[model samples]
Target: MDFLRHVKNILHTYWIGFVCLIYQVLWRPKELKDLQQHNGCVAIVTGGDGDIGMETVRALCRHGMHVIIGVKEETNGQSVEAAIKATCPFAKLDCLPLDLASFASIQKFVQQFKAKGLPLHVLVNNAGIMHAPFAPTASSSGSLESHLGINYLGHFVLTRLLLDMLKRSGTKERCARIVNVSSAVHAISTIDSIKEIQFSKFYCPYGAYGQSKLAVTLGTYELDRRLRDAEFPITVNCLHPGLADTNLFRHLSPVLQPVKNLCAWLGFMWTPSQGARTPVFLSLSEEVEHTSGKYFDNCQAVPSSPSSYDVRLQKELWNWSCEITQLPCDIQDEINIHYT
Candidate 1:
């Protein structure tokens, strides 16, 4: 049975990759434009120092938003801020140190942001590791596989910590936005049980990466449902930025690197600017002002993996995430009390 599951996963990964390649080759995704300026609005983008994340920050800054970049290293954050300011002298930006692998670091980052007394209009969970070597976070909450720890759980904790600020910043006319950068690879992942979600016995790098992305998608849907039910003025959405030619592929094996390079040469992969379109769209477009609980690609709402839509699975993951992250099991109650 395990062998069969592995075969299925491999097939799914290749099939999705093929389809994305064809789509990018056949049609160019449109750039986001003509959106009204976001003056006075504040946004946070995790991993804003990365290739795609840097482009995302640039786009938001170009729209006149005050963007706070969350970086693992303070120097990287400062560098990114300086680089953007060099071009757009009017760009309002700040750098905050954030290490998603550590719960303590995530908490500290939030406290520092709160100290500024700024309202968060958009939160982009953009940082992730793909096909990384097996390394677990030394978090006090509990050791988690690096992909799951930094990719999914860290963003989960960050979002929960800042929920109140998001609520206060949003209004009926325009809702606050949460943009989670998920991937089509999530379709290949399975999380039927808690044990599978936490730690797989035998880890395949691709499988681990896919599982973390699946977790992000599942949590996006579940949180959207909860926030909507509670009448919170925030919109939660996830997207698959088309497979871009980014540093994300640095971990690929030598055997796969040649194939990846060939794809980039053939124009099968997206540029960082192309990859940033959907995320930027979700963050600023009036078209999605009230859109929630949907997965997007190429700036359009599309269905995610069949498993991602499993309501029971979504709730289970949400509950377990709350337990592991030490958040209130009933987050709605916390939000409600804040509003009252």
Candidate 2:
């Protein structure tokens, strides 16, 4: 049995490497040449303090966009600010407090952002927790699984609060973009009903993570559809950043952690920079300026799970998200009224 397990691990590692190699060979993203043109444009990146989120922030700053780094702690924000400045001295950056685990925090962050009177041109929903143990969000009052609350519900509220800003910032020259950093693991999720997602119910760490990621993708599709119907020049898309050795995997059991590390060392994983490629491309590349509601991998548009494209599921998820997040009735009506 032990030998069979070892062989299975070897096969898994090689398969990962094989897929990565194919993507690397086929999809090479080119850096936007006239990046300075984005100067003065504003971008807000959630969870931009470290990992792929930090790398995404770096790429945006280097292109001369004014970046707002959303972090839970001000000190972590300051550290990220200092780090970005060290390399891109011309980078215009601001670190603001944002906790994805709490709806109150998201509302407060939006208020503060609006007070700045800055137009929001890009939003990268890059903050997410993976394989978290059975727990509720910091508030816990809602009994929402931590991963679902933080990864999907938080971003849902954040985006709704800022929809006005994104709409106002759109133009033929620069259509506002929202890039959701999802994962390939979304394929594992088969969430059929809303009741199946409560934190008080049966929980599997990895399964919950997959469900949340799948929600991210569905949210992007619904947002895209609504924006198009409203004639709003905003694009929303999601992508699976190649497997990278980031801190999001810390929840792995001690027994499996070493195996994960071994896989990374054996060339099956990407560095944070490599993982940042698809997101940065989605955020900056002019090629996809009009692209919305699409799933991408390795910086290219690709088919996601068939379930992700189900229009009924998309609407169901959106409405449920609004209800769970406790969005105001009038606000929810206002947003939904635009849909056909």
Candidate 3:
């Protein structure tokens, strides 16, 4: 029975991979073009040094947007800067240090960004950790799991801190964008974990990762609602970049490494550039300019897991996040709408 279960799991994984490949072949994103609208626009991409993140930055730069690449270390940022300059000789790029695991670091990053008086037209919350050993972040609030703290809460706080800049851009362009990079694994999230997070012997790293990603979607929805209520033209959306061969799986146990390698050899994995298509589409695609609070896959709007749409869960997570981060829960009251 144990062997049979393992066989079933392997088959299911391959089946999903096969479907994603077919979908990509049939409905790939249109070739992105440079747009006059992106000239002098400022954007930030967290985890911009990673495979998919770097590709997203490259696409954004090719479109003429001035991009800030947020990396955890100065050296990584330097490397990214060098890479971008090699391809885009005239690209406007800045590499900044951002450590998402530490809230203090997040605050400092935001403050540094604001000190420059830069206008933020796009924010791509693309940095994340996956399936690592369970532990609290160095400065995580109240024993919050590291993955949740880094993957969701850190970006949550970063967005709030940069809200004014984003809102300001909306007034000028009639549209500013926030793109949260979630995952198809979000479908496995359980509301109970999000509402009352507790890790026990049954706790699985992948499960915690899913719950954190689900929070990302819920946060996107709640933020969209707040912006719309205030008549701000800022659009917030989330997406699942297809499974790709990347360093994200460095935490996989030794026993599973062979299986992962086999899958990669089978042509089932997406290249980083292919995985980036959906995020680039959501970030700058004109067709989606008026859209907000939507979940996307393969560069198209799609229904998220039903639980992701639950108002109760969304509110619960939002409030919980505010409480943990010590951000005021009444942010709606603080919004000063500049656009009618």
Highest TM-score scorer: 1
Off by over 4 Å in 2: 1-36, 328-340
Question: In order, what lDDT does every prediction score?
Answer: 0.89, 0.81, 0.81
lDDT of 2 by residue, 1-340 (tens): 5355334434544464457555644655433454345788899999999799999999999887899989998999999888889999999989889988887788789889999999999999999998778777774474778898899888988999888889899986669999998887777666667665553434567667778988898888988888887778789999998878899989877987897797678666677888988888888888797888899887889998777888888888888887776564333244422210
Clashes within 3 Å, all models in order: 0, 0, 0
Candidate 3 residue-wise lDDT at 192: 53
Q: Best-fitting candidate, measured by lDDT? A: 1
Candidate 3 Cα deviation (angstroms), residue 235:
0.4
The collision pairs in model 2 are none
Between candidates 1 and 2, name the one with more favorable lDDT. 1
lDDT of 3 by residue, 142-182 (tens): 48788888889999988987887888887634599999999
Distance from true position, residue 90, model 1, in Å?
1.2
TM-score of each: 0.95, 0.88, 0.89
Q: What local lDDT score does residue 227 receive in model 1, on the 0 to 100 scale?
A: 94
